[model samples]
Target: MSQKQKILIAIAGPTAIGKTALAIEVARYFNTEIISADSRQFFKEMSIGTAKPNPQELAQAKHHFIDSHSIKDDFSVGNFEKQAIACLGKIFENHDVTVMVGGSGLYVNAVLYGFDELPKASDALRAQLNERLKTEGIELLQEELKNLDPDYYAEVDVYNPQRIIRALEVCLSTGKTFSSFRNKQHKERDFDIILIGLNTDRELLYSRINQRVDLMIKDGLVEEVRALQAYQHLNALKTVGYSEIFRHLNKEWTLSEAIEKLKQNTRNFAKRQITWFKKNEGIIWFEPTETQQIIDFIKEKLITTTK
Candidate 1:
């Protein structure tokens, strides 16, 4: 197949929606490899907490970007976009279709549409914002951002102070709306994209999330966090599972309380992921449990797209 014949299948949805299993099955069906779009799973230190594919699944299909880097290294979405593009290109050489799967909406978008390079924020401004975030609390900056850029405030992760501070820093440094830089015009790709989304009932999805969090704890998530505690300050480490436990280690909260927070935060993360993926018009949504329906849909898409 030439560039025009190449097909890219994007498996996206909320966490615990059975993306990993379905993606592997799809890859096996197409005799293709998998490219992960989950940002958290990219770090080598994060396994149980990130819900990496088990050994059996790994053996079932060739996977990329799993445990490929450390948190100590700075890996941005731009880097992910470039690397994923190259990997997709090479995989397409021998395979007609490649499967990219994860719930990380931003990372998914980065590969589908090359992200724009924003003007760098001044060091002085970033330092000031960082100090304010530490002293004044994230709520203060979140309130300010709500006032300054309501659009961004509406969509951003409010609990993540780093995101709030980074948005504000860019706004203050560039004298432009942080949301303005996000107005992207899609870049054409060499292949045709076929987006397959998986969804579940809200109640069921939340239950699955809580159960998964409990499973992570049982799988030594705490020990994993303990091993990486020295690098807690790194941006890559500032995520739901690790950050909540970091609070416990710092004595900010009790172990039990941190675990509760992790469960709640994971549920919230899933809700946000659904909301983000829902807004993307390109996604073809399906109930995850409907395996036969999904397979038939994909086969139909391939026939129509490749013809």
Candidate 2:
């Protein structure tokens, strides 16, 4: 095998764009393995909402980091960066390339660009942030982030109060901009990278997201949420689908409205993911339907690496 054959194919795009299927097919064709970059899918309790690959897909090709942890486990992007790189190192021992597919822009970049080496928050700082969150609410923190770092404020998930608080706490407690430690020099990797971006029309993509949420409900997402409701304040629990349902359970929103918001928020997330990935210069954009063409392109790239 040559340098191109040792390529790391990264499949990323908006949610529900068929990245999993494409990744599986590509992995099978190359007789290689897959490393999931989907951050939500790491929580063992979030199978349905994360759209984790079914057992058949797992049996067809080896996958790493899917349903690998519980919501109780405090997994971070930094931790994922370490584990994913280690997993890829093992996979590279046999196959030239490994497929990493997901829509989580930060997690994907955590693997590709490496995370910032910021100081870990102390327990006291966390407790302070949590207390402020309870008393002052996320709106106050959002305002602080807007004033502290307006660039990140527009890009960050405002609805996710926990993330907002964390960013602000990092700035206020440490006297450093949260975004200050991001997008540093790319760490050199052993294998070449091939970034495959999937795309579709906005209306069609939103429809897919709505339908996926409905499917999750049918697959027992509500029960999963009920089981984890006691830990709702945890950062793991402050996500799109489950957070909205928690509001309904709190009588803050009707069940119907919560479901609606879940769908709407998921759609918005997909939009943000697309915006983030489009700005990445390395990715080659393709329609999900063009699987064979992508495969052939990869094959040619591999051939070029041999020369």
Candidate 3:
């Protein structure tokens, strides 16, 4: 008999789309483990704001990469790609199928289709970009990226200085659009990937995003931020829930205003996630509540492949 291909079921969607719950259900059905590709959930210090899986959910399925790194660790997407691949090697040992879940499109893409070999940035170049950010302001860098790589700018988190600077470094060093280098040639993975994307009406999604933020706040998102104030300068903390609250703690905005901004920013982030996931035609879209249907679809695929 031919060796059965190891299947990696990628459960992906926007924030507040119930990815974790659905991933647990699917992983349970497969009797396998899950690998989290959510960049925010990787840090041990970012539970409340990142909407990390509660202990009960984590207990339902074996999960990797959740709180696997400290906030102080310099974890990059490149590092994640390598670590996730290594984790999968171990997972495929006992199970024929494993699930990968997250809202971070870049991290998911890194595991499914390996990243392209882009030009590396030198220390001097990074320092120059950082200085530009310090003096010229983010608007200037945003405009530069918009002009150079409008496609990436459209999908990326514009408020993220690290992403913006990385794009600019590539644009300046290689004189090429950052988006142009993506998906150039995918590295071969030993496993077959099945992408399942969850989506709903825009209004419903926004509503969920707002509600999730409120719950996070009620769950002491402010206290979480306050606890990690010393690490506020960390790149991991430069996220939606934390950043808005940091501004509030800085007395730049009223607490109420910060809460509203957090909701608005989260909604915007969800929209960007949708835009990024929609570009991948390989994904099979479903409503977030379609648990049985998703399982049946996966089973059908398995049957066809096995035969």
Q: Write the per-residue lDDT of candidate 1 for residues 207-255, one digit (tens) a residue.
A: 9988998899899988999988999878888888998998988899998
TM-score of each: 0.95, 0.91, 0.97
Candidate 1 lDDT trough over 10 residues, lowest sum? 153-162
- Candidate 2, residue 108: how far the Cα is off, in Å: 1.0
- Candidate 3 residue spans exceeding 4 A from truth: 1-4
Model 2 off-target regions past 4 Å? 2-5, 119-125, 159-162, 173-176
Question: Please, what are the lDDT tens digits per residue for candidate 3 over residues 120-163?
Answer: 98999999999998899777999999999999998898777889
Pairs that collide, model 3 = none
Give the deviation of candidate 1 from the true structure as CA RMSD: 1.6
